[model samples]
Target: MNARIEADAAFTDWMQHVQAGMEGTLDAYLPAVTEIPARLHQAMRYTALDGGKRVRPLLVYAAGELFEAPEELLGRAAAAVEMIHVYSLVHDDMPCMDDDALRRGKPTVHVRYDEPTALLVGDALQAQAFAVLSGNVEEQYAARQLKMLHLLAQAAGSTGMCGGQAIDLASVGMTLSLAELEQMHRLKTGALLRAAILLGACSGKHLTVVEQAALEAYSCPISLAFQVVDDILDATADSATLGKTAGKDAADNKPTYVSILGLSESQALAEKLRNDAHKALEQFGNKARRLHELADLIVQRKA
Candidate 1:
């Protein structure tokens, strides 16, 4: 196989592994409160097991690979990141939040279950993410795990995802500057992405200051690129192709890269960001092939 195809296959295999690990971890962690409610658990599984691109978890694993971390340890970290991501998505689709009816080519958690169930499921997933991290890791890594936990909490909490959602809500139908739009995405999407990469690196014995800076620089543009591509897909792709409702952003009159920069400009920006991400890995040379391929794949992803 060609290099690109080989990389794509590797990514696909890694994603499948991450999903299985996430499901297993969730099964073990979710039984903590099995006696209370069936619907809540159903809702939790509905959103959590709903297949996704699993990009965040993949990033975690890829970054860990750069440092030669063990696959089992990386799987645990990947599951933790994915749990946090699913929790954010569940809440994001709530009636009071994005009010999204579709997710992953199916009815969202709120639509499949109910708003209250969705709410609790999101909360449970958030708590369970920490539980997975704390419960599965060795005591020797406790301090590092705590740091990862803190990064996730900060990224998912009020100052990050929630804050970005609030801004998005407030900006609906309102014109925003390019800088403003970028800032919103930085907090909303980029923070968690950066945290994922950092968490993976943190699993190593140490990260040099330069490596830390490089990861941050790389994550910023890639996160925005991810969002930009999302907006483009929402505009041009169908629900079947995207596995979710299409054209919803335009329908909701939401501010997006397409709205602010136009489709062509958004595409150009995504390309530029992809290049920027690759550049950030220059120091790692051929050892960073997976990361480089991941950057290319993000820009080229149809879903």
Candidate 2:
């Protein structure tokens, strides 16, 4: 095969491996549908196992591979991060929140099941994430693992994602300066994405201050870029292509980069962020090839 075709094949294979591994790992961690509170557990499964791209878990495995972290350690950590992500989606789609009725090309948990069941699904997934992380992480890195647990808590709690969501809820139909918007996304979206990389990298070995700095340079921009592209997609794509309610931001009057910056400027900014991600990975040499690919994937993805 030609080099370009060979590279494409490799990329496809890498994505398959990571996605399949995460699916299996998540399956092992999530409660069986037959368990008590069966409805809640089943809803959790529906929300989590749905067809959304496993971006966070792929980041986990990719970054962990850089440090040669044990696959077992990466699997547990990835599961935790993904569960937290799914929980956020469930709550985001609630009547009290985004009020969307579809996600990943299917009816959202709240729409398919009852609102109360969807609420319980989010709560259960969050708790299950911690259970999987704390219960299975190897004791050899007890101190490190504890720090990882704390990191996830901070990322998901009042200081991070929740804080950002509160800001988002308050800012509806209200204009925010670009700085304010960036800060909100940094906390709301970037925090968890950053934690995914850190957790993955930290799983195997401690990174030097310089390496840590580099990873941030890559993750921070890409995190924001992820949101920017999301805004762009919501504006440009249809619900069928996006597998969720497209144009919801405009419909709901939510503030977004595309709203304030205009489509051309937002697209420019996303490209800048993608370039910044590439520059940041220079220190990692070829080992960060997957990271580079992932950064590109975040912006270039259709859904």
Query: In TM-score terms, which candidate is top?
Result: 2
lDDT of 2: 0.90
lDDT tens digits by residue: candidate 1, 196-231: 888887776678899888888888878999999999
User: How accurate locally, in lDDT, is each candidate?
Assistant: 0.81, 0.90
Indicate which candidate wins on lDDT.
2
Give the runs in model 2 whose Cα sits over 4 Å from its true position. Answer: none
Per-residue lDDT of model 2, residues 1-303, tens digit only: 698788778887999988987778888899998998787778888888847799999899889988888777788889999999889999999999999998999999988998989888999899998998887455687877788899899999988998999999999999899999999999899999999999999888888999999999999998999999999999999999998999999999989999899999999999999999999999899899889889989989999
Please count the clashing residue pairs in each candidate, in the order shown: 1, 0
| TM-score for each of the candidates | 0.92, 0.97
Candidate 2: Cα lDDT at 263:
99
Off by over 4 Å in 1: 1-8, 19-21, 32-35
